[model samples]
Target: MVKGCSLSQNGSSSFPDPLLYRQLVGRLLYLTNTRLDISFVVQQLSQFMASPMINHHKTLTRVLRYLRGNPGQCLYYPENSPLHIKAFSDSDWATCPDTHKSISGYCTFLEDSLISWKSKKQTTISRSSSETKYRALALASCEIQWVTFILEDFQLHYTQPALLYYDNNSVRYIATNGVFHERTKHIKIDCHVVRECLQKKLFHLLPISTHD
Candidate 1:
């Protein structure tokens, strides 16, 4: 909702003070831990805290009203799920306006329950959709490593290869194959790391329809 804010101010005197505006934005950001739906909205509001106007305040208030109307909303997980680990990853190609950096997002699940998730902008620009997907896969692999260690701590063993699902077929092929395409040479480390995981039989990559 904060993304709907318009920077309309009648005059300079009508604008809210920067410090107070930032303080409010900070509080909203803190609330995002239990409210994942508000993360995108909070992040948008934070960007305009420096010189907020009445229009920006309107947008912020709308977000607050939304929360007030849905106070009981919370993430719930069911027990008695299977022990198998699975992950899904994807990347938006050059979604950022300023840097042309892609955003990598992945969600890990232990059966029906979501165990881990991440949404981060890539540090470098990717030249192809396959490269964007590769970066996302690398991030998902790191998450799998961490989760595997935690499971080992509990004396639970995952004998089967950890399943990683990707919607992009090109990236899946690249992961299963050792040869690198010309477009992917820029991120050689990512290619090597994913290839190594495949060889070690630590994880398995699978293709899933985008609809899934």
Candidate 2:
């Protein structure tokens, strides 16, 4: 999807073949298991499956073209990988122009090999970007815990705190500074998983450049 571009059910002619659109999108959904690059775009297009529009079809075609042009792109797991856990989580606040809801995404890596990831729309309306980032971080924390369980099953464990990168400094303060809690009262209590994880040494928060 184009940066700053928002798609909606309005202002477009409906696609002529809804079934074909659905089929193509279903294939794209399956491909997301390996083609992580297209996950966000597939999520956007899937929203209009019931009433797909011409613009949606055009976007889907572009994704397909990109995939065809880069068939070699795929998940690669290298040999002799170390037992390291790291993750990156982010959110686009109020990205859905029609609903004003946010989208959160996170991807985890074990020794530089991608393992788990997700892209989903937030259920509640977020009043601020900080709240959205907190939500995304909370979800990513849970995913990291799940990955830890898998590692334990292999008789392995990450001795160091999992490095979690986010693009917001406020989030780091919220998780690290107790005084920061007073300012974050507006944020929901459930969104403070980062704080708990930090105290328990489950993960270490790091600021990352948005462009990265």
Candidate 3:
């Protein structure tokens, strides 16, 4: 998908054959298991499978061209890679022009290798960017838990805290600050998992620049 591009369900001429669109999108969805780079675009494109537009198919073809150019791209799990878990999370606030809902996405890495990831819209409207980010953080926190548990099952452990990076400064302050504030009350429920993970030293939250 294009940067800052938000596709709407309505408008544009509908594709003549929805089956072809569905088949192409389905194939792309399967590829996302290893082709993490195209996950976001594929997710966006898949939404219109039932009734794709010419614009959507054009975007899909663009993705196909990019994939053809990078045939060797893949997730590599090296034996020398450490077992530490690091996660990155972000949200596109009010990304959906129609519904005005946000989208939260996250990726979990086992040391230097990307092991798991996701890109999906939020379930509810976020009142602030902080809330959107914090919710994303919570989702990432859950992924970290599963990663750690699975690592433990394999008798592997990293003593250091699992590092979580997000681009929101408000999330950093909200997660770190214990003080109760009226501004944060509405989002208190969403912050619970993240704060608990912090208290237990499960994750070390870090704020990053989106531009970076």
Best candidate, TM-score: 2
Lowest-scoring 10 consecutive residues by lDDT in candidate 1? 3-12
Taken over the whole model, the C-alpha lDDT of each candidate is 0.76, 0.87, 0.85
Q: Regarding TM-score, does 2 or 3 come out ahead? A: 2
Q: Is candidate 2 or candidate 3 better by lDDT?
A: 2
Tell me the spans in candidate 2 whose CA falls farther than 4 Å from its real position: 209-212
**lDDT tens digits by residue: candidate 1, 90-207:** 8778755546778787888887677776667788998878788899999998888788889899998877778988888788777776564444677778887787777888788988
Off by over 4 Å in 1: 1-15, 40-62, 181-183, 210-212
Candidate 3 C-alpha lDDT tens digits along 25-95: 99999999898899889888977877788888889889989999999987788879877889999887887
| Clashing pairs counted in every model | 0, 0, 0
Pairs of colliding residues, candidate 2: none
lDDT of 2 by residue, 31-124 (tens): 9999889999999999999999999999999899999999999899998798889999999999898799999999999979999888999998
Q: What is the TM-score of each candidate against the true structure?
A: 0.76, 0.93, 0.92
Q: What ranges in model 3 sit over 4 Å off? A: 180-182, 209-212
